[model samples]
Target chain A: MYPKKFENLIECLRKLPGVGLKSAERYAFDMLEYSEEDINDFIQSLEDLKTSIHHCERCGNLSEDNLCEICKDNRRNKNIICVVQHPKDVIAMEKTNEYHGVYHVLNGVISTSKGIMPDDINLMTLLDRINDETQEIIIATNPTVEGETTALYISKLLENREVAVTRLAHGLPMGGHLDYADELTIIKAMEGRIKIK
Target chain B: MYPKKFENLIECLRKLPGVGLKSAERYAFDMLEYSEEDINDFIQSLEDLKTSIHHCERCGNLSEDNLCEICKDNRRNKNIICVVQHPKDVIAMEKTNEYHGVYHVLNGVISTSKGIMPDDINLMTLLDRINDETQEIIIATNPTVEGETTALYISKLLENREVAVTRLAHGLPMGGHLDYADELTIIKAMEGRIKIK
Candidate 1:
């Protein structure tokens, strides 16, 4: 229905998550309407993102250099490290602006059903970093069954380590309604109930 | 929250429709996981779409060359022209596979509220094509009030011409539910009622 170039554009747009045929068509047509300079800027950004940014050697997080911004910031707590499943999770944690600690990105969780093993995750550097300099390690994986499994496995692996190991507190979210909450959430919320003044 | 290049990529991805900050982050990180060659191919496709695809000189539809594929096809009914509002609409019509006639894209409709006038549309070429050789002209705009206005305007403009000017049949679609149909649609269905076997 269109030129080869236009069809090629639609195919590329389709690669984005949740983008269907109609959506890809809309995105392609909209991009074609942009100025040539803006389109060039977009393409340049894509190239830069693919070529420049890479995993930080210190914490296994995304960075321009060997060390990420968090790792380079002396003001942050170097001893406290938050372990997460992905680089995007690191972004989510940063958005809070509350934590002044560094992060260790595992890049993925160990799922036995999916054939993902503990060795497949970025945990070797983490173990090497678990020296006297590291005071605490917080396992902040998602609250799924796989996440809990991975967290438990990591905590057990660090049983002989000198550093303190902890997992994220699980309970009902703020402003959550109990009626709509799942059984696992209810149990966690019940067990972690706080005392009222 | 991320590197300069990563942030730039997220900003560019945010230009897409329905993509929020989280969705943009997800899209960028997902692309980073893709192979470098695949990323380069995607960027090439984007550049080609912006610099190559343009309105056809013959019928105002998208074309790599001067004329669109539909207009260049000798097998199609060139004399029976289907007038549409946009290039995307031409794609939609082609997807039906029922239309074998050539197309004339007006690029836009007469929206009085939006200050879009008849001169803003690509109507001169359409008028030039309406000679003795032309047999029929189908006004196949959307189902909106603006579409109806454009169709009426076109039909009235060709009142003195020798060609038969027509509009798409307004009625209940096949396998449509009468109960769920709007009042205007039901009225159109009643007006355009056909004989049953």
Candidate 2:
């Protein structure tokens, strides 16, 4: 138990995912004991993050300006777009440093149960961006049911177009054990084996 | 891996005690995905806490003004004071509602290894508050080596004074297991058995 103000802080901290009552209390106490300069810095950082950051108009990724750095970078290939479900996925792909193509963040996958549809996404904007100059559109969505459905829908929509469509090669990960690999991964790896595809 | 700004957030979060790299990343993502309204609310709440809260000058407990609510309450006996190591202990005692006296927060206990001594604590102010009218002083320090040393030093200092010194009873707690009890607790329980001291 704590004073009303401390309790309010604890409640706010508990609202964070995975933080329980004990952890909330610890965080509240830590905040309370933080040096004035540290507290100000933390508060200022939060305020800056909230007020300064926004979704990139082109790719839906987090950015300080209307266009993200990736979308604006001239070195990246604008002709090849790697489509992903969320902004976090863009970061994950960027860590590999293998893809020089720009990205198109879907924001979310098409979930029929959740009432999300093709129209709800930025599909039209994506289609409008594609022209004779566009070489390829890569579907880098997760290997989940919704991701597959969304990828299929996107592929079907682009089927009549001249640009090529491709999905990430499904297979066992670099360090994965064959015994522990899921049935789908093994099957997909088998079906999509590169002779070289 | 994330954008430079998100990576900055994670680095700042990692500065907090007990939060490691993984937890910092989790907190960063949580902040990113948090609703705009919720993020604003959290930031505003942090601002409110920093602007509204003040430490009690008298007892070192957190308060809205110069004195904590407990110290301002006239019904509490000023003639008897319970001394503790931290403000959290004051909250714990307040929950019991059994203590009717005021409090004296030492802020910390004596630790020769840490270069802390009696003068390092708020002991001078505590002694100044003690008058001929004051009847008792309760040492509610935790049952640690440092706490015991601090209590002994305070008791020796008060030996010539008219005040009666007391300590919190040490024994098997309400839901405690005797088999799991440490040697010091069992010894203290035996030594502190009720006597006409």
Candidate 3:
């Protein structure tokens, strides 16, 4: 058995997503054995993360201030907006280094089972941002049922206006075998095929 | 890519065992999302672990002060000392609720491959603790080759002393099948079998 103070450490570690009792115990021992300077650095970093990071007012991405770096960059195409489900999805798309447009994080996709709707997300703000100058609205949502439903709802809402809507092309993974491909994926790949030049 | 301030949080999370790039990224995000009050509690608990936990002066086990509860208990037998390689091992043996004597932690085991010798361990303090009143010394090292070598070396060093030296019994685990056993495990089990009365 550990001391009462160690119990507190275990309890705090258990709050982590995947950490359980044994993992919490191992983490407590690791922390107990670490040098004072290293422990202080860990704790200080956690505090800094809590205090310094905030959401970007324009794009809903995480940043240090109201405006994220992408929103503040004048060189970027403000007329093209890439709609994503979460801030992490924006980062994942950014890693590809292909898209030169701005981003709009919806924070979550529409889920009827969870009682989430288009109004519950940042859809109104996105509509307000749309103008005659806006050329494209890329629906970069995930390839899930909820993502497809959300994309359809957004597309229908923008149909009354003059903005062009597009979705990411779906296909098998780069290294995946066609023999193991699922029916839905093959159907999507066929439906999203491009025309020859 | 992340900001310089966020880099520290990522680095700290990466240092943890089994936490790779993706896991570190998730942990950093979780920390960034944690509330200020939760961050304060985490920092306070870390500081408490550093300032409050101390090694037991007699056995080197973790304690709130110089003496652990087991070492300070007047009813426990002081003549027999169980020597372990680390404080976690002490907790494991204690969980069995079988041993009721004091303990001596070597802090680490002797490993020539790692440039560690007998002198590098806390063996000298253990020798100093032995007296005429001492009866037995249990060597509860792990079953690794390094652990066996350390146990053998300690047994040889104490051969001339009056105290009786012993080791934990080893064999196949309960309900284990022989066909699934490894060669080293079979050898250990064969070497440790007892004769019937």
Candidate 4:
């Protein structure tokens, strides 16, 4: 119901996560109204993202160089590594201003249903990064089944390596009401309950 | 917490309607995961949309050439013209397969709050197209206040002209419940009530 090139642009916009056909149409129409300079800037940004961004060699996080900013920061504790499933998680963690240690992005999780195995992700590089001085390996993957399985697999691999491995706690989120949270979350929260008094 | 180019891309993606910062970040990350060929194809589509697609000179509808397909089609009724706010509305009307008339896209509507005047849109071109052969002008702008205002303004403009002016019916949509409809819609439905056999 649109011109050929307009329909093509809409199809490309639909590739973005959560964008549907109707929303894609809206975006395409909105872009059509954009100024020529604005369109050029938008195209330039896409080109720059494709040409400049790559994974950090050490932690597998997104970076414009070989090493990510977190990996290159000398002040950050290198002895402790927080492992995650994707680069976006590293940004989420950093937003909290809580994690001082560096990160190790797995980039993928071991999902048997999807046929993803231990050999598929950045697991080997993680092992290579661990050394005599490395104090802890925090498994901060998501609370999903695949995340738990991957965390268990990694911890099992490091069982005899003399380095401590730990998974992130699972519970209701901060400010999350009990009535709204799912049963699985309630179960985990009850199981991991701590005595404050 | 993202690299410069990655953040830039995220900002650009946020320019799209309904895409917030978090969703923009997701899109940026999602695009990063796309294959090099896929990325190139996406960029090519954007370029094509910018360079190839333009307004149909006759009707102001989006087109790859000077005249839109509908405007050029011999089967459609040139005596009847459906005036709408945007090209998207033309697509919506075409989906019904009921309207065989060509469209006159206003490209905008008269909005006092937004400072949009009838003179700012494609109103002049619409007047230029009207002649003694033109049988009807169906105003199919949206159901909003601005739409009503624009419809009234256009109808008034053509009051002196020879062509007949009409507005699309404002009634409860098919399958719409009267209980859920707003007061204005209910009033309009009542005002436009038809006699049963």
Highest DockQ: which candidate?
1
**Judged by lDDT, which candidate is best?**
4
Runs off by more than 4 Å, candidate 1: A170-197, B171-197
Clashing pairs in 2: none
lDDT of 2 at B167: 73
* Candidate lDDT (C-alpha), each: 0.77, 0.73, 0.74, 0.80
lDDT of 4 by residue, B38-147 (tens): 77777787787778899999999999999999998999999999888888877767765667889999989899999998889998899999988998888777767888
Worst 10 residues of 2 chain B by lDDT: B188-197
How much DockQ does model 4 earn? Answer: 0.62
> Candidate 4 — which residues are off by over 4 angstroms?
A170-197, B170-197
Cα misplacement distance, residue B101 of candidate 3 (Å) = 0.4
Ranking 1 against 4 by DockQ, winner: 1
Fraction of native A-B contacts kept, per candidate: 0.78, 0.31, 0.46, 0.82
Q: What share of the true interface contacts does candidate 3 keep?
A: 0.46
CAPRI grade of model 1? medium
Query: What's model 1's lDDT at A135?
Result: 79
For all candidates, state DockQ relative to the true structure. 0.64, 0.34, 0.44, 0.62
Regarding lDDT, does 1 or 4 come out ahead? 4
Off by over 4 Å in 3: A114-124, A171-197, B171-197
Question: Could you give the candidate ranking by lDDT, starting with the highest?
Answer: 4, 1, 3, 2
